[model samples]
Every structure is written in structure tokens, then in C-alpha cells.
Target: MQRQSIPALTMALGSTIVLALLGGCTSVTPPAEPVDVVISGGTVYDGSGGEPYLGDVAMRGDRIVYVGPQRDLAARRTIDARGMIVAPGFIDPHTHAEVFLNSPDPEQRVNAAWLAQGVSTVMIGVDGGGSPDIAQAADRLETGGIGTNAVPFVGFGAVRSRVMGEEDRTPSGAELAAMKELVAQAMCDGGRGFSTGLFYAPQSFAETGEVIEIAREAAIRGGIYDTHQRDESSYSIGLLASVAEVIRIGRETGMPVHIAHIKALGVDVQGQAPAVIAMVEKARAQGIEVTADQYPWLASGTSLEASLLPPWALDGGNDALRLRLAQPDERARMKADMAENLRRRGGASAMLLTSPDLAWTGKTLAQMADLQGGNAVDTALAIIARSLEHGGGQTNVASFNMAHSDVDLFMRQPWVVTASDGSNGHPRMYATYPEKYDAYVLDRRTIDLGNFIRQSTGKVADIYGIEERGYLKSGYFADVLVFDPGGYAPRADYLNPRELATGVTALFVNGALAVENSNPTGTTAGRVLLRPAPANCQVRPR
Candidate 1:
């Protein structure tokens, strides 16, 4: 059949419509097409650092089909989100989430701790613990199922340990080459970046040049460099110097530098937030991309051994440490060192043991020391020895080291996004989002609600280059949240750290309703988010 001209087709169709109208035959109205879900009458934040607006956001399947003012679109389910905040689901850039994310039990894997905080996505394998075998890790996550999206990185600690095994020595030329290959391989296997906890040992032994060389692999492959800088206080190179090192890494490697849990930690660095912020801004102006994530809390949680012991003591693993603790001269040397370190972190009373299922869980170090009729250092060493003798686990403590003013200063920075740094037996894992909202947004008014939401959502995604998952926009993934203002607040504190946050009324992961009416629907709708591998290399199949 020949195609009709536009005028001819229009004339014929117009005549037919005219005849039908004349006969009153074009009278029946067609029904509105139903979309999968319509979220109506909410104060939408949109995650763009914009003012809140009353609007509706519509989702269909795994992507958003519409997001704007309502226009009578039909829907299978309409969520009346009146008086609630509709925003993109939060992205936690730094988290030790693998504790729950890698669990075999579906319930633990659901990650209710973060789920109730309105988080739809979490970056796992953080703090220099990310897997080099990212492909296999992703495969396991997808196969076993999860409730929140997970991204992976190739860790400096993991790679170095694989090559050196805590030898406290620089890598040989061949060893360094081997480590670089592992980084490149991991990047090709879809790692988003290279992460280092230079503050932690084994990795601490790696100097600036070593880090630059190792991280350069990730840089050339288009991945960022994330680090928990070598020191946040006057511990080693000093906080300011450590920050400079992070910047130097970026300037040299040509990769963006991200500081994890940026803070002015401990009594020694109590008022250094402004200086740290200035350093980051200066670096950014110099064309080195720098960003950081912070949890809204006063106390910083870390293992007691990490906080007190020297890296040299941790050189040959727990066995060597046990030997050191037993030697008279070595033990005396460690005691003096620990005492000085104790002074660096406030005093014994400033450290509260928080590791779960332990006899010393709730007491402050000072109290424990008093009970044992010993000095803080001796008491601490005793605990470490017992812990090592039994199972070689870390004696974790919450150091009340950060000043409120310092925390406030860091929180106000635009480049600093929100993260949980969520550790076991810590309230931050479950309540960081709500805590920020309740304490910073609602009470202190340190940041307005829209800025808070933007920092938690789109800002983080922008910093990390997350594809299509951090905005309530058309064609983006349907990772969204609806929460009641009155109900959304932190339920956990140091005294009761594992309590789940309250008031995420509706949560969607990839457009699936993972939580409805503030209850989980038992759906593991998460996916393994991977960056595209380098074009020169084929990604290892998972």
C-alpha cells in the first residue's frame, strides 16, 4: 500500500471525526492509563539541593517514569504521602556494611539497620577491607540476595596484605608490581575505586610514594582514590599533614581523593575542623577533586588495640603481639607508649568499651582500671591479652574524642556528605540518617532540611559518580523514600546501639517496595552496582 500524504490523511481523518461528532458517536471518554505506582501529595526534596515543593513522583518498574506536579495519572497504587518527605534514597559512601550484607540468613542480609534509616543503597567493603576479587563478591551478593544496592572497591590493605602479610616493610620492586597488577585486575573487574585505611596498620607502613604508585593503577583506569588518612590527630604525621598527603595523592595520581569519616578526632586535634576544611577547599581550587563523608556523632568508634598499640607491635600478627606482651622490656615499652596514646585520646574515662557480648562492653576504661586496681595501660593490656588468648578479636571502644563544635564545623561543609561508618554495636549503623535529620536538621538547624537531604542523596552520588540512583528524576532508578517528619528520628544511642531507626513509611529499591507502611516486605530487591571495566580489559565473569 502507498503511504498517504500528511494533508490527505489529515483531511480523511478529520472528515471521519466530523461525521462521528455530528452523529454524537465520539462521546465515550477513554480511561487514563494506570502506571505502576503514584506517590501523590508529598513535599519532594528531589535531591538537587533545591527547595522543597509539593509534587507527585511516579515510578514504573525499575525506573521513574514521571516526577512532577500531579496531572490525574491513574495508578495501580497511590501512596498518599501528605505531610511526608519524598526524597531519593540515601547513599552511604562509607560503611562496614559487610557484617550484615554478607550474611547467609535472608533476614540479616535485609540490612534492616540501614533499611529503616531510609537507605536504599550502601557502599560496602569500606575502611580498606574491600575485596580484590570484586567480580566474585558481586556474584555472591546478587546470587544470595540483599535489600540494598552494594558497590565494591579494591582495597589497599587487602592487596598489600596479600603481598606482604603484615611484614611492616616496603614492597620489593617485583612485589610492588604484583600488587599493582591486582589493583588493575580489580579495576577491570568493576571496582569503582581504590580505598586505603592508612590510619590502620599494615597499610600504615605503606608510605606516600608507595600509595601513589599503587593508587595510580586505579587512577589510570578511571577510578577514584578513597582513604582513611594516616592520622586524624597527633598520632603519626599529624592530622594536617595526613590531609596534605591525601591531597598530594590526588594531585600526583590524577584521581579524585575522598577522605572517609573526616573529623578532628581526639583531644590533640580538637579544633582542627576549619583547618582541614580549608585544606580540602584549597586542593579543590587547585583542580584536585576532594570530598569527605561524616557521621553525625561526637564519639568515634575503633578497636582498642588500634587506638592504643603501635603498628610495630602489630607487625607479625596476633602471635607476635602476644609475645611482645609477655616480654618484660617489651611489655614496659608498650605500657609507656599506650599511656601516652591514652593521653592523646582524652584519658581513660574518655574511652568506653562497646564491643558486643563482652564482659567489658559498657564500662569506661577508667572504671575498668579502677575495678582492676591498676593503671589504664595495664588494665587495657590485660584485656588485650585475654582477648587474644581466647579468640584474637579486637577490643573495641568508643572514644568520646570529638568536640561538638568540631563535629558541627565538619557537618556544615558542602563537600562533606553523610555516611554511617557503621560499625558493630554502634548506633550510627542504624541511626545516622535519622540522627542527622533529628539533631542537625530539626533541632540545631545547622543545616536546613533540603540541604540535609541533598547531602545525603544526590551530593553523595555526585561525589562517588553513582549512575542514575541518587535523584528523584525521570529515567533514574526508583530508589526512593517517603518518611513521616514526626516519626523519623534516631532510636539508637551508645547505650542501645543496635536499635532500628523509626519512620521510613515507604521504601523502594529498584522500584520494588522493600518497605511499605514502615514494615519490610521481605524482598531482597538490591543489585550489585558495578562500574564499567576498562575497555582494554575484559571484565571477569561473575
Candidate 2:
């Protein structure tokens, strides 16, 4: 014993075990297989809404090849993931990552903020804000270099803006056909589907029939329709009716419908989450596929003009709106309309100005108005005017319109997945996933860890028909994460809006280490994902 080395001791112990078991141990123990990377000794949440089990995950190239209990898996690189949670890297189904990834700045292209929170794939062109030129977009992202995988939606806003130039009227036959062609081409070129922000301008001008037709094009091409519904409150058709409209689109088009940032917003419809859930459930029962994504925030972020102005007022673009705001008769109508809109949004106190241009990034509309020596409406009008002068409609506001109860209720729905709807000025852009985990799973116990991972990863992938990703299944793409259980949290808040989140210990994108020790490895290993061409263009008959 004094002369025996550790290896000799181990060999003697193994021989004794083998002799005791009569070769049972030898028969059961498989030979070690070498892999590119091995993540060992972690509690694995498979991202299938199931219970977690202690296991090791091994990757070869860009694919996961093993997911089971402690295997003798030899690897080029091994991650000692003891006392950590190994999960599928989160898929952000809604994010404005394009705004940064496409920017000339290389620093923002890494998207370290999202990477630090364990996001491996980001869905862009959400809320009707993507390009119709899918091929060109893919080229742009590839040329610019991206940190997280990017999937795109052909934005309804872009499509309409291209063809109609913000016209308030219905498209002509030629324009409609042109729009449909653009959408079809986009789908064929790898666009996930047609994304419409009907709540915003231009797309808002399109009627139900127009949306149905446009959505049908994507549907026929095996694409899903993702929408920021026409109304989430009393802005136009109301929240309940907007839900019904989305259901109608799905039912009529025979396409899957996914509501982006689904919520019952404002004081007027604060408690309508149940109604929305009922509608989606009923549609699902009737053989319609309907799903939704929501960020874990009580307030919804949007432009000041988009949230308050009537769609008609935004017709003919910002120039026309500014002209109207200058006319006394027009201003009266706008004021009257905005007052009701503000009321629907739970009044001035419920809105927070989030634009960095103004000196009120974290202050409520009422407080900002008081400081500026005016009522909330006048203050808003002035800000919008000033924002227009800057040659871009970038007046962002964090509308504290949703109730916590409604948010919690929506979070409990099975069909509801997680998304950021992330934009520049909002905290949700950088903090959504971690915020959801910290507040909902860790702190509140509202949702368990397994289901949380499922909603944030697999469920989103499944809903979008994203193949070879999302779940931590063997043979799947190895987009994975390892994180400390106690250390997972978001650092980005409304005041420090652009700060990156913390707590992700490591993230692997396509078998490459993209984030290590809660920091980006400066590795731009992401690829652009595209939809496959549809087998048939046949849609259900009207």
C-alpha cells in the first residue's frame, strides 16, 4: 500500500470490482469515444419540458453526439460543468438584433449582450421590420460577421413600404401582386415567414383581407405568420378583436400564426389575458395552430408616435404627420384621439420616456411633462416633433401598460413562448431571458427551470419549424449553454439600458465556444438560417 501509486490503486480497485461482478461491469462499460468537446457532470435540462437529470453532453464538430450519464468520452476539450446547469442555448424568437448586426460598427456585431445571457440564435425582422431581400440580408450578415445565428422574417412593413411608400389606401392589383411576389421570393430565399407589425404604420394601413392574402403567400410556402397584432388595446380594433383577427388569419390561410409579444396591454385591457388564451385554445381545438411570444416585463417598449398616434395620422409618412400636427383642425383631432389613446394606455403616468435624446430616459411621461412645464399630451407632441427633426422616428417609450397579473397569466400558458421584442432603448433588448429566469424561475417559482428552458428554447424552435436546433438531443446542432445556478441574473436595467447581462459561464454555438466565463470570445461563428422551399403552393380555398 505504501508503494502503490494512485493508478495502481485504481487498477486494483477496478480488478476487485470486475471480479466481484463477474464481467458485468466490463460488459456494461462502453469504450471511450473521442469527441470534439465534452461537457461533463452537469444537471441537464433537455429543453423538452421534462425533468432534469445529471448527465454529460458531448459534441463532435457542430453536432451533439452523446447525451447520457457519465460516459468515458474522450474529448479535445472538456468542460467541467459540476454544480452547473447545462441547457440548450436560448432562442430569442423576437429581437431587433439586425439594428446592430447590420450596423457598420464591429463591436455591436458580436452581440455579446445576448451571448452573455446564453442566447445562441436570434430571430430578426420581427414586428414587420425585416428586409424582403433575404439573400442580400444573408450576405450582409455573413460579410459583417455575427456572433449569434440569425433567422429572418420578410417584414410586412418593409414590403409595404417598398411597394406602397406608406400610402394609406389599399394596394392596387399590381402593387398587391408585387408585394406577394416579394414575399414569395423572400420565403424561397430562406425567409422564415411574413412578419407584420400591423400595430405600426404602413402595415397598419393594410386591411384584414390584405394581411390574409400576404400571409397566405408565406403560408403556401410553408411559412408561419408572425405578427404584432393590429391592436393590443383600444387603439383600433381592440385587443380581443385583434386576437380574433390573428386566429382568422391562421384559420383562413391554413398557416401557423404566432403573436409577437402577446399581451393585454394598457389599463383598458389589463385583465384580458384569459380571453386571449381562450381564443388561442379554441382556435387550436378547431385545428388551427396558434402560438405567441412574450418578454417578462410589465411594460411594453415602442415608439412614442406608434403607441399614441392614430394610424391614419401617420399616413403619407412622417412629413405628412408633421404637416398635420401643424394644422389647428388636424391638431384638434389628433389631440382628441391621443387623449383617448393615452387613456387606453392607462394615462400619462403609465408611460415612461426611454429615448436617450431626451433628458428623461427613465422618467414617466407625467413627470417629464411636469418638468417641461406642460401637460403630458403637449410634452409628447413636442418630443415627437423634435424627434422628427432628427430625420428618424426614433422616439422610444416604455409604456407601463400591462399589468403584472396579466404578464404572469400569459407566462403560464403552454402555447406562449419567450421573446424580447428587443430594441435599442428598452431593457428587454439585453435583459429578457435572464430577467425571466431570475424573476420567474429562481425568485418567484412561477415557472420551473425545465419548463422555462423549454419555453425559451425547444418550444420556440418547434413553433418556428426550426430544424436541427433548440433541444439538447444527440445528433442535434450543438448550440448549448453552461451556467452557474446561483449566478444567473440580468445586469441591464432601464437606466443602464445598453449593459450586457451576466451569469452565463459558457455558450457554444455550432460547436464553437462563443462565450466563455460570461464574456464573448470575439468569435463570430454564427450562420444565417433560411427556410426551405415549400413542397406545394396550394393553400386552403377561401
TM-scores, all candidates, are 0.93, 0.92
After superposing candidate 1 on the true structure, give the runs of residues whose Cα lies further than 4 Å from its correct spot: 1-32
**Number of the top candidate by lDDT?**
1
Which residue pairs in model 1 clash with each other? none
Which tens-of-lDDT digit does each residue in 1-542 have in candidate 1? Answer: 22234344324323432332233211122224567998987777788875566677888899888877655778899999976779999999988889888998989998888888999999876778887999899989999999999988899999998988887888899999999999999999989899999989889998899999999999999999988899999989999999999999999999999999999888888998989989999999999999999999988989999999988889878988999988999988988889889999999999999988887888999999999899899999999999898889888788889988988888888898999999987789889999998787666768767678888999989988899989988889999999987678788889789898888989999999988877778889999898887777667666
The candidate that achieves the highest TM-score relative to the unseen native structure:
1
Q: Per-residue lDDT for 524 in model 2?
A: 86
Per-model lDDT: 0.86, 0.85
- Candidate 2 ranges with C-alpha deviation above 4 Å: 1-33, 535-542
Return model 2's CA RMSD, one decimal.
Answer: 7.8
Residue-by-residue lDDT tens digits, candidate 2, 60-151 = 98999887677777899989987678999999999988877887888788888789889999999988988998888888898889999999
Clashing pairs in 2: none
